[model samples]
Target chain A: DQQVKQNSPSLSVQEGRISILNCDYTNSMFDYFLWYKKYPAEGPTFLISISSIKDKNEDGRFTVFLNKSAKHLSLHIVPSQPGDSAVYFCAGTNNNAGNMLTFGGGTRLMVKP
Target chain B: GAGVSQSPRYKVAKRGRDVALRCDSISGHVTLYWYRQTLGQGSEVLTYSQSDAQRDKSGRPSGRFSAERPERSVSTLKIQRTEQGDSAVYLCASSPPPDRELAYEQYFGPGTRLTVT
Candidate 1:
């Protein structure tokens, strides 16, 4: 069974608009959630992360909201730029599990200029 | 100043061949991890090593897969008798120990794409 899932295979947004990507996970033990962005032929880069203790975390134009009770999380990118186009992966892990992460299938985000 | 790196960015192998993929983690990082991403799938953890000792390997798909991190700086993922189903992009990541909160995030390599015929 997939512990983490990104139901949407892709998302598109016009530049300067808000882009929202959603993720759902079944593992209740997961306490740490993270987002990673990947460009073709490049490694994934850490984007942001949130601990279960908090409902939201933000970094500049990027914000991650977690609804632990719903086992759902969403990544919001405001004023999306063409440079933000990439594959976004949501990952989860139990802090006690020593950093081994379980990743979602990924959502391809395309920000049109 | 370098991030994790994997060698032979792309590899094509015939069936029954043995292949070894290498990863070089950033200096001083004490934890290394191996993961595989198949087409249309998420990256799955294959194994993890702390320092020079393997902490978990339960994710290795089968007996054909094995990994080693010697000297705590570099790691190798070896596949024996490769099969077509074994094709995937193998990714390596590393991070500092958990004691350093900000450094706990993993840095990934570009990944080695292995295609088995």
Candidate 2:
């Protein structure tokens, strides 16, 4: 079963606009969440992460919001740049899971300049 | 100073042939992980290395898949009698020992694309 899911397969936005990507999870044991950005033929790179205790974490133009009650989280990139066009995958993990990361299907974000 | 490195970034194997994919983790990192990326599943953990126990192979699809970590810094994933269903991009990642109250962040290699023809 897919414990973590990203329903949106693709998204498009204009430069300088806010790009929001959403993800949902079914496993309650997951206490930590992270976002990774991947380019064609390249491995994913770490973007941002949030702990279960917090509702929101922001770094520069990127922010992550978590809603524990709904088992959902989202990543927001503001003033989106063309360089941000890539596939984004969200992952979940917990201390008891032996550091194994459960990933979503991924969302491809395209930013038009 | 380098991240994870994978060799022979691409491989093509005939059905029923055996193929070995390699991964080199960052120096001093204690954990190595293998994952396969399929069209629908994105990426799923195939296995990971552990300190005190035999490596975890629970995610491996079948007995045709096996992995060996002879040294802490290197690992190899072997697929025997490959099938077309096994065609996918296999990725490798490494991380240091995890700390409580914090998340384990893994650095990944570019991945090796294996095509079974």
Task: Per model, state how many residue pairs clash.
Answer: 0, 0
Q: List the residue pairs that clash in candidate 1.
A: none
Residue A26 displacement in candidate 1 (angstroms): 0.2
Cα error, candidate 1, residue A108 (Å): 0.5
lDDT of 2 by residue, A1-113 (tens): 89999999999999999999999999999988989999999988889999999999999999999999999999999989999999999999876766778899999999999
> Model 1 chain A, poorest ten-residue lDDT window?
A93-102
The 10 consecutive residues of candidate 2 chain A with the worst lDDT sum are A93-102
- Candidate 2, which segments miss by more than 4 Å at Cα? B52-57, B100-103
Fnat of the models, one by one? 0.81, 0.62
lDDT of 1 by residue, B1-117 (tens): 988999989999999999999999999898788889976689999877787785346465578778887667899888899999889999999988777885548999999999998
Error of 1 at A37 (Å): 0.1
